[model samples]
Target: MTLPTITATRYVLPLREGGSLPGVVEGNDLGTYVIKFHGAGQGPKALVAEIIVGELFRRLGLRVPELKLIQLDPAIGKSEPDFEIQELLIRSAGLNLAVDFLPGSFGYDGSAGNPGDQAMARILWLDAFVANVDRSWRNTNLLVWHKNLWLIDHGAALYFHHSWMPAEKFATLPYDASDHVFSIATPDVPGVDAELAAAITPELLTEVIGLVPNEWLEDGDRERYLDYLTARLDKRSAWLPGGAR
Candidate 1:
């Protein structure tokens, strides 16, 4: 399950809506992508989180855009008019993360209607398990493309790795889903957990983690990620929405 690597051929535009300042890029494969720079404010760890969480979401049978490893050349953005953007490109030379650009897609709002109980529950369950705090109603981090829901911007998930804290410590941390975009939908998180937990085996996690680039991880970080996620999965009783029985 390796991600195909593509070279950034041109810098199309900057997406300033995000704090990280990702941009639209044309890839050597002739495809357009939303490129997340390794040099963004969040740094490479954000790209690592993006790959791991996004891939995990896809494996769980949810909708997410295709991900790729984008090889960037700082010179590509030399002609850019924005100094900040140009400097960002210079810093991001080498490798970066990118997603297939979905045209005609719009941010998810309540106007299109709810995604239903089961689907909503699944999304909520996944976010909780990964400790994703970015899917709040204010940000949503979801997209509507051709009337289908697509998850995006998982770089904010798996935040426990930012420090040296024991991964097990975060295993039981309660997720505040009250502000989740689907909070009003009343998802049956426990029921969804029962249906999905078994699918998150260590083997599946290993495969998903393998998708991340080695350059993006520091010494022992790979093992750390595996350990943390494994512990999180095993200790679901402590954080699986409903109080532990």
Candidate 2:
């Protein structure tokens, strides 16, 4: 099923910590969301990565906040005094990506206790699968809500897609797992890889890609993205910990 799109009703506050200048927006659906703007320095590619990778995690049975397409109205930026934010809001006065806001959520200090072996392994494996380079110790990009770990800030994943090289060229690239904030030790990498391999089928990948809006696609970019992901999924052994076996 596809996610619902909602119009932002109110801009509550800016999340200064995020590099993209995401803001807390109240949607017409009576939901609070953390929105990522299309005009951010990272560009629309970041939003695409967020939707694809985040949905992939959800399909894998992992914990991630619900995502939505947020429609931003420029009038909301007129009241803002910050020139930078006002300009960004004006530029991004269109469709953007938002994640459901979890109240009382706190940054993961790596002290709320471990996520266990299976969970950690699956997370690491997914990171490797997508070549996410931002999950280091310095910025976990993870949140704690209701005593469970929730993944967030996935715009940095899928870096390989940004390059001009043919997708197959980077499909075999190696991913360094040492910097992962959560320890990868003792996790069943091979098992998780096998499970995900079976679960992330062709139809599922297409569905995840379909979540992205057409306006975000430039020329053949969407088809290229789908081709790259499908190719990587078929040749996952090169990037995955264990061979695709």
Estimate every model's Cα lDDT from 0 to 1: 0.88, 0.85
lDDT of predicted model 1: 0.88
Per-residue lDDT of candidate 2, residues 125-213 (tens digit): 88888889898888998999999999998999888767746788767777777788754542467777777878888888888988999
Candidate 1: stretches off by over 4 Å: 185-187
lDDT of 1 at 183: 71
lDDT (tens digit, per residue) of candidate 1 on 100-197: 99999999987887888888878988898999999987899999999999999998999998884787698887788788887753447777776688
In each prediction, how many residue pairs overlap at the backbone (N, C-alpha, C within less than 3 A)?
Answer: 0, 0
* Candidate 1 TM-score, true structure as reference: 0.97
Give me the candidate number with maximum lDDT. 1
Best by TM-score: 1
Error of 1 at 152 (Å): 0.3
